[model samples]
Target chain A: MPLNITLTDYGVGNLYSIRRSLENCGAEVTVVRDMKEVLDAECVVFPGVGAFDKTMEKLQPYREDIREKLLSGTPALGICIGMQIMYNSSAEGTTPGLGVFDGDVVPLVGKVIPHMGWNQVVSDDPLMDGVGDRNFYFAHSFRGNPSEDITIGTTEYEGTEIPTFFRKANTYGTQFHPEKSSTSGMAVLRNFISFAESVL
Target chain B: MLTKRIIPCLDVKDGKVVKGINFKGLRDVGYPPELAAAYEKQGADEITFLDITASLETRQTMLDIVSETAGKLFVPLTVGGGIRSVSDMRDALNAGADKVSVNSAAVKDPSIISECAESFGRQCVVVAIDGKRVDDHWEVFTHGGTKPTGIDAVEWAKKAEDLGAGEILLTSMDADGVKTGYDIPLTAAVADEVSIPVIASGGCGSKEHIYDVFAQTNASAALAASIFHYNECTVGEVKEYLRDRGIVVR
Candidate 1:
C-alpha cells in the first residue's frame, strides 16, 4: 500500500518538490497547506525554509493541531528549519520549538554562519541505508544539538561535530534535505517511506 | 583528510543543457539528465545546474528537469539561477538537489542567504557570485554578467558568509572560457577572507591549473564547463596530476 505522506505547507516551504520526490518513490504524497489536511496521514513531513522566529509565528495557530498529530504516533519528518523547530529553542530566535527532542538549535561556531557545500555524512541509522561516509551536500548556519540518543548521524565543520540527521521515537528529522541530496539522499527518503509503511 | 572536489556546471534553458563561451556563443549541450549521468560516470565529485532562463515559465521547466535528474543521479547536485525565495530554494532541494545556489537573488536580498540556511541548513545552500575585473578590482555582476552590481567581490564574499552562505561559487566572467586558468589571486583573496569552502569557477585549462588553484589559492574545489564538456581532460586525469603534485583528492 502506498503510504499517505502529508507535507505541511505553512505559506513557506519546499513541499511541492518534496511531494513529487515522495510520489516518485511510490508514496502517496499530499501537500497539506491547511492545518486540517494533516488529520489523516500515515506520515507527516514539515518542510521549512527561512527564520525560526518567522516559522514559529506562522505555525503558532496550528500548534495544537501539530501536537495532536504528533501524539497520535504518525511518522513525522522535519527538514532543515522544520527539523530545528523540533527542538527546545534556537540561537536564531527566541521562539520555543516542538519539544520533541531535548536540545537546542545552535549556530555553527568558529566557522562562518552558513556551512555550505558537500560535507561528509556519518550514517548510523537504518534510514541512512545506502549512504556512505563520503561528503553529502549541506547548507545551514544553525544546527540541532539533540541528546546523544537522538543524534542519528553527524557532520563536521571546522573540527566541531554537528548532528546532520536526528531521530527519536516515530519523529525523525534531517538537517540535510534528502530531496536535494543526490542518490544517497534519495535512498534516505526511500528508507524513511519504507519505515513509515512498515510501522503503519 | 578532505577529498578534493571536481564539479561540472551545467547551464540550462527550457530544460535542456546548453554551453556557451564567456556567457556568449551558446549551443545546446544535451538533456540535463543525460549530461548529469555522464558527469557522474566521469567521476565528477559534484554537479551544478544553472538555469539560464530568467522567466517564470522557463523556471518551471528547470524544476521539471531537476526532478528528472534528481531521480536518476546520486551524486551531489547544486541548482542555481533565478532562485529568489526560500520556497524556490526548497523547490530545488525537494526536486532532489543537494544544494540551491543563488546569485542575483542573494545580491538583491542578501538576507535570503540566512533565510535559506536557517530553513534548509547551511550545507544545502550555495551562493554563486559572477565576478569581473574592473580597474584591477573584482566587481560582482548580475543578469548573466550583463550588468554590474557595484559590489566589491572581497567585501561581498565576507558578507555572504556572515549572511549564512555555506559556500561561494566564485566565477570570473573575464576568465570563463578563456582557459587561461582560475583567477588564483582573486580566489586566494576570497578564500583568505572566508572560512567556508570556496569553489573556484570560470577558468581551468589544464591539470596544472587545478593544482595551482589549490596550491596557489585556498580554494577548496575547482569547477569548469568547456574543459570538461569539450573533452579537454577528464576529472580522473586532473586528480591524478594533482595527487602527484601532493594535493589530496578522492
Candidate 2:
C-alpha cells in the first residue's frame, strides 16, 4: 500500500509541483488545510514559498496540533521556507516558527540576494543515498542554522556554509526544493518516502 | 560563488514544439514534454516554454502541457507568451510553472509587473524584453517582436526592476537567428542598468558566444533555442565548455 501523505496547503507555495512530485513518487498525496487532516496523515509535508510572517500566520491555528504529531514520531518533511519555519524563529520576520527545532533561520551571507539555481550537496545520511555529490536546485534568501547534530547535508555559497538538509529522529527538513532538483532530487524524495514506509 | 546558467527555450505552438526564424516562419519540431525531459537529462539549468499560439484555447492546452512536463522534470520551468494579468500568472503557477515571463502585456501596462510581483513574489515574475537595435540604442518590441514600442530597452529593464521584476529576459531581435553571437553591447547595457538577474537570449550559435556574453557582460544566464533543438551541442557540452574556459557552471 502507498503512504498516505498529507501536504499542508495554506494557500501559499507551489502546491501543484510538490503534489505532482509526491504522486510521481507513488505516494497517495492529499492536500489538506484542516488541522485534523494534517494530524491524521501517515506522513506530513509542509512546503512553503512566501513571506515568513504570513506563512506563520496561516499556520498559527495548526501549530500545536502539528507539534503534537511530530513529537509523537510522525514522519514530517519541510521544504525551503517550510524548513525555515520548523526552527524557533527567522530573521525574515518577527513571527516565531513552529519551534520544533532549536535554531534560527537567518539571511544568507552570500552576495546574491536569492541564491537561485543548482548547487552541490555533500551528505552521508541515508537521505543522501544515491544523491552523491550531485547539485540540487535552490531558490531562497534565508538559510537554516539548525544545531550541527541535526544537519544531514551542507552546501557552500560564497564563504558561508549553510545547512541544506536536516534530520532529527522522524522530523526532516531541506532548505532546497527536492521537487525542483531534478533526478537526484527525486532520489531524496524517494528516500524520505522510504523513511515514511519504514515507520509504517 | 553562484554559477552561471544555460537555459534551453522550447517554443510550443498548438501543443507541439515549434521553431521560428527571427520570430517568424514557425515550424513544428516534436512533442514539448519529451523535448523538455531530454533537455533536463542533458543537464540544462532551466527550461522555458513559450506558448506561441497565445489564444484562449491554446492557453489551456499550454497549461496541460506545463502540468505534464513539470510533473516529469525536477528543474525550474518558466512559461511565457500571452500571460496578461496576475490571474493568468496564477493559472500558470498553479499548473506548475516556477516562473511566468511577461512580454507584450508588460510593455502596454507597466503596472502589471508590480501587480504580478506583489501577488506572487518578485522571484516568480520575469519581464521578457524583445529588443531591436534602433539607431544607436535598442528599442523594445512587443507582439512577439513585430511591433516596435519605441521604449529604450535598457531604460525599460531598469523600470522593470524598479517595478518589482526579479529577472529580465532580454532577447535581441536584430541578431536573433543570425547566431553570430549574443548582442554583447545590448546585454552589457541592460545588465549594467539593472541589479536583478538578466538572461541574455537570441543569437547563441556556439559555446564561445555564451562565454563572450558572460565574460563581457553581467548577464547571469544565457538562453538558446536552435542550437540545442538542432543538436549542435548538448547542455552538458556547453557547461563543460564554459567550465573549461574558466567560467563556473553547475
Candidate 3:
C-alpha cells in the first residue's frame, strides 16, 4: 500500500511544490488546513516559506493538534521554514514556534542574508541515507540552532557552520528544500517515506 | 562561501521552448519540461521559464507546463513574463514556481514589486530589467525589449531593492543574441548599486564570457539561453570550466 502523508497547509509558503515532491515519492499526499485531518494522518510533512511570524499566525489554530500528534511519536517532517518553526521560538519575530524541539531559530551570520543556492551538507542520519556529501537547494535567511543532541547535519557557509538537518524521536527537519534539491533531495524524501512506512 | 550559480533560461511560447535574437525572430527549441530536466542533469543551479506568449489563453498553458516541470525538476524554478498582479503571482507560486520575475508590468507600475514582495516574501519577487545602452547611460526596456521605459537601470535596481525585491534579473538587450559576452559595465553598475543578488542575463556565448561577468561584476548568478539550447556547451561543462578557474559552484 502507498504511504499516507498529510501536509499541513497554513495558507502560506510553497505548498504545491511539497505536494508534488511527496507525490513523486510514490506516497499518497493530502494537504490539510483542518486540525482534525492533520492530527489523523499516518505521517505529517510541514513545509513552509515566507516570514516566520506570519506562518506562526496561520498555524496558531492547529498548533495544539500538531504538537499533540508529534509528542505522541507520529512521524513528522518539516522543510525550510517548516523546520525552523519546529523550535521553541524564532529570532525572525517574537511569535513562538510549536516547541516540538528544544532550540531557537536564529538569523544566519554571513555576508549573504538569504543563503540561497545549492550547498553541500554532511550527515550520517538515516534520513540522509544515500545522500552523502551532496549539495541541496537552500533559500532562507534563518538557521535553526537546535540542541547538540538532535543535530544530524551541518553546512558550512563562508566561515560559519549552520545546522542543516535535525531529528528528534519521530520528528525530522531539513533547513533546505529537499523538494527542490534534485536527486539527493529526492533521496531524503524517499528515506522519510520509508521511515513513515516502517512506523505505520 | 556562497557559490556562483549558472542558470539556464527557457523562453516558452505557447508551451514550446523558443529562442530569439534580441527578442525577435523566434525559433522552436523543444519542450520546456524536457529541456529543464536535461539542464538539471547538466548541473544547472536554477532554471528560468519566460512565457513569451503573454496572453490569457497561453497563461493556462504556461501554468500547466510550470506544474509539470516543477514536479520533475529539483532546482529552483523562476517564471517570468505577463505576471501583473498579486493574484497572478499567487497562481504561479501555487503551480510550483519558486520565484516570479516581473518585467513590463513592473515598469508600468513599480508598486507591484512591493506588493509581490510583501505577500510572498522578498525572496520570491525578481524584478527583470531589460536594458539597452542609449547615448552614455543604460535605459530600462520593457515589452520584451521592444519599448524603452526611459528608466535608468542602476537607479531602478536600487529602487527595486529598497521596495523589497530580493533579486534583479538584469538582461542587456544590446548584448543579447550577439554572443560576445555579458554587459559587464551594466551588470556591475546595477550589482554595485543594489545590495540584493543580481542575475546577469543575455550575451553569453562562451564559458569565458560567463567567467568574465562573475569576475568583473558582483552578480550572484549568470543566465544563458542560445548556448545551452543549441548544444554549444552543457551546464556541467561550463561549471567545470568555472570550477577549474577557481570559481565556487555546486
Give the winner by TM-score.
3
Ranked candidates, highest TM-score first:
3, 2, 1
Question: Given candidate 1, what's the lDDT at residue A1?
Answer: 64
Cα lDDT tens digits, model 1, B48-143, are 998888489887788888878866675667899889899888878767676789998899999999989878666667889988989979999987
Give the Cα-based TM-score of candidate 2 against the true structure: 0.91
Candidate that would win on DockQ: 3
Each prediction's DockQ against the real complex: 0.21, 0.51, 0.58
Q: Write down the worst ten-residue block by lDDT for model 3 chain A.
A: A107-116
Which regions of candidate 1 deviate over 4 angstroms? A68-72, B1-5, B13-16, B20-29, B40-46, B50-128, B133-136, B139-151, B159-167, B195-197, B233-250
Query: In terms of lDDT, which candidate is strongest?
Result: 3
**Residue B8 accuracy (lDDT) in model 2:** 95
Ranking by DockQ: 3, 2, 1
**B14-52 in candidate 2: lDDT tens per residue?**
988887423212242487777787888888989999998
Task: In model 2, state the lDDT of residue A191.
Answer: 89
Q: Which stretches of candidate 2 lie over 4 Å from their true place?
A: A91-95, A147-149, B20-29
Relative to the true structure, how large is the alpha-carbon lDDT of every model? 0.78, 0.85, 0.86
